[model samples]
Target: MGGGWIFAVIVVGLIVAALWAFTKGTPTGRQAGSGSGSSDEVAQLRKNLRVKALGNDALVNRLVQAERNRMPGASEAACYKAAIESWERDNR
Candidate 1:
């Protein structure tokens, strides 16, 4: 009975810790700020890759425009990578 209470308390403590972490985003190497914007860029990149993989020229054009709008300063290497990935996916 005592063990069960201890286990319950441990579980509750873990739950509270998880909630706290969720509310307070985990710290990373990036500066104190720049969390949300970086995450948004990553999310946009993921969406761009998926859309590019669909292998429609019109859609690809739209992806390019959307990406430029999202991050005009983004590297050309990223664009090349998306194209290569799309070609590979389409070929496969």
Candidate 2:
């Protein structure tokens, strides 16, 4: 009976570990080292827009559009500016 209990515990532990591993597989899509449109840039823009938006959906949509229109090889600063412009345009 004790041996059976141990086996059950081991099986449960293995199942839990497997589930954790599966759920933890890989992170977000953005890669920091991917260059040209790094995660940092995207993250920074998100942060800035979040702050500017102050929980407004309209501003959020503008931010999304800005990010969607982001060009390759564009710097984070440029992206930020563009996003801001989009937000401002829509805001007013």
- Top-scoring candidate (lDDT): 2
- Stretch of 10 with least lDDT, candidate 1: 23-32
lDDT of the candidates, in the order given: 0.52, 0.61
Candidate 1 C-alpha lDDT tens digits along 8-80: 9999999999877643332221224443445554444444455435646576566556645656675643443
Off by over 4 Å in 1: 27-92
Task: List model 2 lDDT by residue over 1-92, tens digit each.
Answer: 89999999999999999887643332322224545565665665566567667867576666666665766556664565567656666677
lDDT of 1: 0.52
For all predicted structures, in order, the TM-scores are 0.32, 0.36
